[model samples]
Target: MASQRGRLTMGLVLILLAMTALAGRALQLQAIEAPAYASSAASKIQRAYTLHPDRGQIVDRNGTVLAASEPAVLIFADPLMISRNGIDERVSMGPLETQKAAAAPKAIAKILAKHLGGRPEDYRQMVTKTESDGSLARYALVRRHVPSYTYDLIKKDLAAGKWYGISATQDAVRSYPSGTVASNVIGFVNSEGQGGAGLEYALNKQLAGTEGKESYEASTYGRIPLGRATLAPAVNGTYYTLTLDATMQLTTQKALASAVASTGAESGEAIVMNVKTGEVLAMASMPTYDSSNLSAATSNEMVNHAIQDSYEPGSVQKVLTMAALTDQGLVTPDSRVDVPASISSGGGTIKDAFSHGSLALTARGVIAYSSNIGTTLLTRKMDKATFIKYLKSFGLGATTGIGLPGEAKGSVPTASMPDFTRDQISFGQGLSVTAIQEAAAVAGIVNGGVYHSPTIIKSARNGQGEAVKVPVSTSRRVISAKASAEVRNMMEAVVTLEPSRAVAGYRTIGKTGTAQRIDPSCHCYRGYTASYVGIGPAENPSILTYVVLNNPVKGHEGSGVALPVAQQILSVALPRYGVEPSTSKPPKAVLEYQP
Candidate 1:
């Protein structure tokens, strides 16, 4: 009886312990660990995929495609299929089976390396990466922007199961078809498919479209079966239409290239603007680059000098001073002023290009001859406040809003500055102005002294193909029509008919600039900036052109170097735009003073 009771007690205790253990395990799984296990299971089955949106085309005014996005592909892989360690299912395997599984990627790598130009060993590492759990990685990058032929070869292999786990998606590669023509204006996209510089950088927001997304049930082997997917479609980028004329832009670039080589200039820039409409017809810079391969481009090659750089503008600014004198009725082209060859103000001497002691000149003569001393004397008639006001009215000391990135607002001295600063700035010194700013300011004189902001983008279209309206221009009348006429007449005298750079049949008006360059490090005079700003068809001017040569080694005078370039661009542009020769005879220039 005692032995029976002992056996029964032992069996009852064993049964209680077993029941308690089972209950605890059930509680842990159903209550404590349920959420975590559920999350892990969902993670193993579901994934969210990114969809890339299509970028837009950048075209010229006449539908010439300057920049566009071409079809491309981005290659990816399913880690489970490519990586031995990525297989989640446990299977009993022998040594030979394991060895064969490990060597599969090596075979695939050899095939990929043949087309991609990388070593098979390097590719082997990319395909065999694993997760923390020693399972195959879910995703891997192969290549981006693969050409059609290369992608086709890989796709064929993938379809035949010659390579497992590889896949590709539709993508785009940005291309500049014109190839180095207007590259500075068009800019380039970077390796990551983002706009890096120039208009590419400026209009990136409009050009880079919205990214799309899709969520679906994918197989453990990394295949999307298609019907279970939910997609949020991508919105494409807006198309850009620039005001640049392709033919004229090419002409201007060739002219700049020839000028930079012939004159041995460090760099050069040229701008052709519509005097009446403020349209930037063509802007060109030397040392330009191929926007396709910016990685090889230098700092100089990347800059859009026409709008980004500012120089002293030299005597090209004298036209503005002459116009100011005529506008206020303080002087006229006929009014005479006694001027010395050199004058002293603010303890600094201002001299002409040539010394003529106690000379007399009309206000127009000051501009026609580009006499610095004469212009300085003319400023004496107006107060400092009025003079500075006139400068602002002409769009100086501010950006011209030419729809480009990295535009510079050229510097101007304060109205209350010393007489030396005043004198120098009055004749295009002691101040900085960009080529576009000078062009727009000259355009003011061309458009009857009404200032209009310069623009490069002619029009634009949204992704939905809706026309995007350009911003309404804010223009203000700076001078009367009569004053602008006299200024144009004076400038016309600067470029005469016989033995002149002006196209024989067309009437021309211009100003020359030979300003000393200020070194950035020492702030001292170094080389020279030779420049010329001209207007044509003097009876009713239509176009305004500006050319600037930096540190010309061969010539120091504007007439010698810069004038020829200005004439070259205008001679081609005028005829291309169908501008006719002046029917009337050239007007007589009364350069001699009559007191």
Candidate 2:
């Protein structure tokens, strides 16, 4: 009897202990860990947050907004909401509960079908299929990249519960006000709002502002109170005011296109820079791409030719060589030189366009005639070292430090140069340079011998209209005033004396060159690169224009083809800049030559 009682007591005690442990577990689950699990369950029920970014804007110099951003709506769905409403189970039943399951789907279909521009049956199929699988797909996108009108309609439908599981949050998108004007320079962004090319690529970091964060508490339905929110707004991108003038850019583009088409040439490029300040008033290339539709054009056509392509600058380089020689006082406008029909150098014979055999030529006459022999004789007066030094000083074989991307620093032959190579280089051979380099060098010659580093960005400005002056390098006197005057005078005579090739009523000064194009296969001269460089108002030069035509078909010459283009551009650009005709006559010191 005693043992039975003891066993019974122990059994009762064990049962009580087991019941107590079970009760404790129930309390812990319902009280202590309940909030965390409930919050997790709520999170799974609906989206807790939406990310929005402030889209960037691109503006012009005159505060005309080229590109802007506007608020937009983003659409999404909530799977948990549909599941809680038993829409999932009903939809999953297929043909059996198809009627009930499809009721909600049909409602969603009818509401969203118009927005998506899809058939009601299609929307039903898409919504039912997604709901059945307990999945939330942004089915049918019910309007992506939505505008304001569409957003209003969708919002009203959501408020009426006509479309379950649908939601929209605020977002921003890019807008271009000027349309395709200056498109190539302003550039565009990808869908993710990242800049790709042109000023966009050049100033990406500044344009792409710092992104911010949003942290907030939400209800089980993942819908926040209409007003209650903890939010951090994104910092908007900085505005860029370009140096490009929309009207001037358009005019230049039109001219370039006309010239390229009329010449029957492959392509062409042109730039109009301010002589006093290196502000690029107009820069353009033919076969340009629309920044809005850049992908539509080929890569070759999209490149900025003014800064990228390098060719034998031909007689354009003569400006530099003459500037160098005259600066050193080794040759003056009247300095006499013996013209040879052809001179042998580097296993090749350099010949003039039209040979002047054993004739007496003045320093200015050598330039006027573009005599390979006369210029060579003059360069022989200066050793190779001095010549190379002057070339460097003129920014040859180097970058122009123009802020554009893909700029080419052209080459000057530095290896295995024989004594004869000096003569070839003196007349703008055995060297290659970019159009910008040539333009900047010529600008130096005409702009009082000061070579100001070329610039495209006018000034870096802040939001307050206060600009931090981006200091341009001080213009250095690369040549004396007298030398500049002499070369300037000679160039003027080339245009005036050759009136048939000159623009009437314009005092233009320039040189024409036709350099033999090197044969890729044998490294011999097989074709020609034609170029003409000119400066206007020869007495007091204002604009320096360089036009180069490469490998022209049907035997083209610089004087015949390229000079005409230079004249056309000057006639139009000079009058546009309001530069008056020079009353001063061509300097009598110009040594006349018959080329």
Candidate 3:
């Protein structure tokens, strides 16, 4: 009897112990782990979505839109939501309701195809796609970059069914508003809305704003109504204003295309600048592609030739050589120099393009006639080292830092070289330069010897649409005001020679250049590069323009091929840009050698 009582007491204790343990577990679940459990449960029902910011607008100085981003949507779907929202009933009813429910995917696809422009079968496959666990896909991509108006219709139709799965996420689409105008300068963005080339690539940071985020309570298939909603608003990108003028850019491009067609040249580049501020008004390169249709363009057509490629600048080098000499008090425009038809140096013969006998000419006349021998002899006044120093100061051996893509750091002879190197360098050989560098160099003479790094980005607008900053450009004096003024007078002599002038009543000061393009295969002269760089209304000059033609098949000389094109641009551009005509008469020019 006592043993049986002990057994009963043990059973009671065991039962009491099990009950106490159950109570402790319930207390722990309701209190100690309650927050963690609630969080886990909420996470399954809550959706977090990323909000893409709108890319900034790119505009010209006149506020004309060049590139911009438009509001777009990313189409997505909730297959489970479509299945749960009685989509089966909408398709059909009757004894075959189960079979009808199975056909919901096909029926839904047909409706989607009506508005989305896709095959019904294709969308049906998407709607019925299963996950690894055999459940319908909760989320699926339908389309991206759908315009807002289109998504609105889809959203309205889906709303009637209590979130029937068709939905959209936020995105953006890049648009080039100006089409092919300044296309090379204002590059294109890829389908992913990323900048690819030109200023678009260079200044993408200011153009691509930061993304935001959103969190909301959601059902198994879509966002829950009247549920929690929290959002971190997106920060829109900053705006950029360029220095380019749309009118000038369009005009220059036309002139370049006409010049190339007429000259039978492979390609051409032209640049127009505000000399005082180094602002690029118009920069055009031929064989260009439309920014809106980038995929159709060849890589060659995408280059910004004015700033990207460097070529032997030929006689245009004399402009700087003369500038350096005059700055050093080595010669004046009227100082007399001896020039021969040809002179031998560095185991090679240097001569004028046209044969001439020995003659004494003023320094100004040497430039007007473009006598290679005269320039070589003139360089004897200064050593090779001094000449190189002047070239570096002209921004030849380094980048112009024009704040553009693919800017070439052109080649200049280093410390060690032969004596002929000096003669060659003096006349624009043994080196290379971009059209921008040459134009800016010429502008130095017009702007009283101060070389301003060429500028394209006028200002960066903040999110508030106020100008906060600008791209970096350096400006410093390289020659005295007097020296630059004299050089301008000398350049004027070149433009005003004999039966024709570069332009009438403009008092244009400029230089013509013709260089042999070395064949890449054998390093022998195979073609010619004709070019011209000039500034107009010589006194109080405001505009500096440069033109270069590669592989001219018709006229090869700088005078015949390049000068006329430069004249064409300046004649029309100067008058329209409001540059006043020169009131002073043309200077008495010693265009021919004396004695």
TM-scores for all candidates?
A: 0.91, 0.81, 0.91
Supply the TM-score for candidate 3.
0.91
- Give me the overall lDDT of model 2: 0.69
**For residues 1-595, what per-residue lDDT tens digits would candidate 1 score against the true structure?**
9999999999999999999999999999889999999878767777676777778898888899999988888877666666542343456656865665576687777778887887988787667777788876767788877876788887676556544677777778889999998999999988888888888888898898888887776654564676356788777888988888988899889888888888888888999988778888899988899998877899988888898888898898888877787899987887787887688978878888886878777776777778888888888788878888888888889887776889999988888887778888889898899998888888887688787788888888877899877653468899999899888888877887325767767887888889899989998999999988777878888877788988888887887788888888888877777889889866787776655
Write candidate 2's Cα lDDT for 165-230 as tens digits: 666666666776776666656667776567776667776666666555565554434546662446
Supply candidate 2's per-residue lDDT for 390.
80
C-alpha lDDT of candidate 1 relative to the true structure: 0.82
List, residue by residue over 240-272, the lDDT tens digit for candidate 3: 889999888888898888988998888899998
The parts of candidate 1 lying over 4 Å away from their true place are 1-40, 84-100, 132-134, 158-161, 220-227, 469-472
Q: After superposition, how far is residue 109 of candidate 3 from its true place, in Å?
A: 4.5
RMSD score of candidate 2 (Å): 5.1
Q: List the residue pairs that clash in candidate 1.
A: 86-135, 86-136, 315-513
lDDT value, residue 188 of candidate 2: 71
**In model 2, what is the error at residue 57, expressed in angstroms?**
3.8
Q: Comparing 1 and 2 by TM-score, which wins? A: 1
TM match of model 2 to true structure = 0.81
Worst 10 residues of 2 by lDDT: 81-90
